[model samples]
Target: MESYKKTNKPRILNIVPISIGSGEVSLGPLYISSALKKAGFDSVVFFPDLSLIMHFPIKYDFIQHQLDYIMKQIRPEVVTFSVLSTNYNLSKSWAEYIKTNFNTTHIIFGGIHSMIEGENIIKLDYVDAVCLGEGEFSLPQYLELILNNKLTQENSLNITYKLKGKIINSKKEQVFLSLDEYPFPDREPLKYYYREGVLDSANFITGRGCPYNCFYCNAAMLNQNKGYLRFRSPGNVIDEIIEVKAKFELKKVIFSDETFTMNKNNLFKLLELYKSKVNLPFECQTRVEAINDDIAKELTNSGCESITLGIESGNEYIREKYLNRKMKNDQIIKAFHILKKYNIRTNSFNMIGLPGDTEKTIWEGIDLNIKAKVDSAACTIFMPFKKTPIFEWYQDKKLIIAEPNTNYYENIVIKHPNLSKLSLFFYSLNFNTLIKLESNKFKRMFKVFLWVKLFFLLFKGFLLKLIKNPLKLIAMNTFMKNYYGRLSVKGIIE
Candidate 1:
């Protein structure tokens, strides 16, 4: 690796605030960096090596060393982090460390957490400013202002900062850029995506914003803007794919839209253009309600390899009352059947331990997934993230036991009136097994086996605690947290 010598060329570094092993080509930082580049400023994206931070015994010193190395190499004049609630504390700590050590460098926080917690975040002494709305729109303006020494609290739009011991919340409305006005997101930061001078797979968003108001998500909050649900024209999308294909061997594309099929006409036109011009196998995510026979047919004909549907919960009451998802179970089953009819692989995204979730309700969810006959399913515990409607609802009901931890898989933070954290943990361990075991004949035996396995795990945990082996115990818990869908019960029948 070559080092970029320190220069006075207004170098900017955008951080994803996660481990390098993830290999995620984050669109947020890429888009921001590209926007800055278009504005005539030098920018680079940095993904720190934090593999050691994944385990229970976090190697803080090693991570700090890696960060220091990158910071010294690039020597960015300004560092910006795209923060998420899951890594808010870690990002904060990193910011504090950078500000303390690299005192001259300016620090800016942006992303979902900052959009919701801007004023509070800017109150931190180390934070220079907090960016709200799309960075592609505000970041370039903010940087230009800083360069010209014209940046002031009154003039800042979509930015919150502290001035003269008082926090100034910008009153100006954010300028939203049309999708076509922006350049293609820079892909240089994602080294892993490029193999042998070809891109193995890439994630691109055709549009922004979702129509549904899922309480647990920030989409509803983001949709308040009049121009939130903007999309690039079908021609613009085709041009990007063709350009990328010309430059590299593109094996696949993943549309990371909130709802890829929300606009039926636009999606159909895009699919038609894509099929005729660039028929690369791709995947996308959409709501169950958005899928229909025509949509399925279009997707299949356009070389869609897979589709992920958000079937958050099985219980209708919980889906409607708690999550604001009003689709019926019949709709979900029908959608899956339609996709299957088109020979498209289906993956269902499910969540357990929601605010109103019970053992019976969780079982209902598993049963629904089985009925849907999904090829694959993923289940995650419900983490009450700050600023989400569910978190505020929980706060109103005094259900919050403690502030949410970084790991959503650790346990449920909310104090359910009926279900305990241990109970929810056990349910999460067995959730996938129940869905994959579709045979009623073997289900009874499987249920018994699951309980026995749970008891064995509990006993092992107790012994580890008794022996004062906290590190091993933490490792065991982490392993089990992600072990939901990996187990196979075919051996039992054999």
Candidate 2:
């Protein structure tokens, strides 16, 4: 094994602990890894086994073997796990294993889960520290302390540490970096997906954070309402896209911002620059409230092949009161109509099985997608994340069915008095089909194929588990690549 010791810098390994379905690279770890590399530290990002859903019972020995193999090669001094509430348990298990085998190695946790539960997570015996808020600047600073052998709880910003039998969170004020201060995320870790033809498009974020305080969304809770939305200059963004275009064979560009049309003037400038320079068909996500006729026209002119709008629930009461998205159904329908008018594709993101969800409400959601004539629809059961207002409300009502450490991708989290978990799962699985049926989008031949697809999905878990471990691993790899690779291009009809 090649020793990183020759570099005279501590080696850091970052693990992104999430199930991959869309073949998209995680930008969080890439940003921090790039910052560490720029600061002359040895850092690398690793993605463990990807699955369609988190609840699939892949073998522990296989998972451990993959990690052990990587550790033997890199032998990092510090191991960091980029965590989400859905994958916290998986990360905890890995962190504990690393601490047990490599007793001298330090383990750190970061990302949304850490921001919400840093103090509690740091209390774990294996976790040396939890990084709070943004880590691009703070993480490099933390590593400098480790290098100088001056590491202590008091010295780092945005870090919570355990020392001397006490948990200590840094008193230093957190520093927020401007978007341009960030170097382009290191795409080296994502090369495996590209080489294997799993990823066809590059995922980039022009900004960080969101302005809206949706109850179910963790953005507000993650930043603690510090007003963290910030975007890079249009020129800065174009430079990165130009660099990425040169580096890879990308078919499309995905701007994975929470709200791409947040600022009209800035967005227009970006569109103009993109149309003239990049000219590649790109897709982005935005709120229905952010859409207008002019915005829709600009998007299409700039080669926006698709735009995803969050229509979390169809029942107006459920949408406004429960999810805190105040837009009316008329506005959502209008947004989709305008995008479709301009020949740009539209996709709606819906959440079934939310609090106060009933069969009637679930159907209303499907009906709304049909009414809006959405080109594609995606649905997920709502997961109440820790420390969010919705989670607290669910707790107050005693409606949560899952355990405290439930997987984020669990089929159902809250138990409604009138709705069963099975019903909700059924609704989510058939959501798109129901919409297509109502909209008359499916032909007889297509309907037959859809039924077969639904059957495979309904019994997918059991079928995958029936396979032996070795075969299961191979089956899963091939399934994820083909399934998610198609999804990555679902919006592009041509």
The CA lDDT of each predicted structure is: 0.77, 0.78
Q: Tens digits of per-residue lDDT for model 2 on 359-382?
A: 779878988999899988888777
Q: What's the residue-level lDDT of 386 in candidate 2?
A: 77
In terms of lDDT, the best-performing candidate is 2
Provide TM-scores for the models.
0.85, 0.86
Looking at candidate 2, the ten consecutive residues that score lowest on lDDT are 49-58
Question: Which predicted model would earn the best TM-score?
Answer: 2
lDDT of 1 by residue, 169-228 (tens): 874676577899988887666544354433477778898777777888865787787777
- Residue pairs whose backbone atoms clash in candidate 1: none
Steric clash pairs (candidate 2): 86-408
* lDDT of model 1 at position 399: 84
* RMSD vs true structure, all candidates: 5.3, 7.2
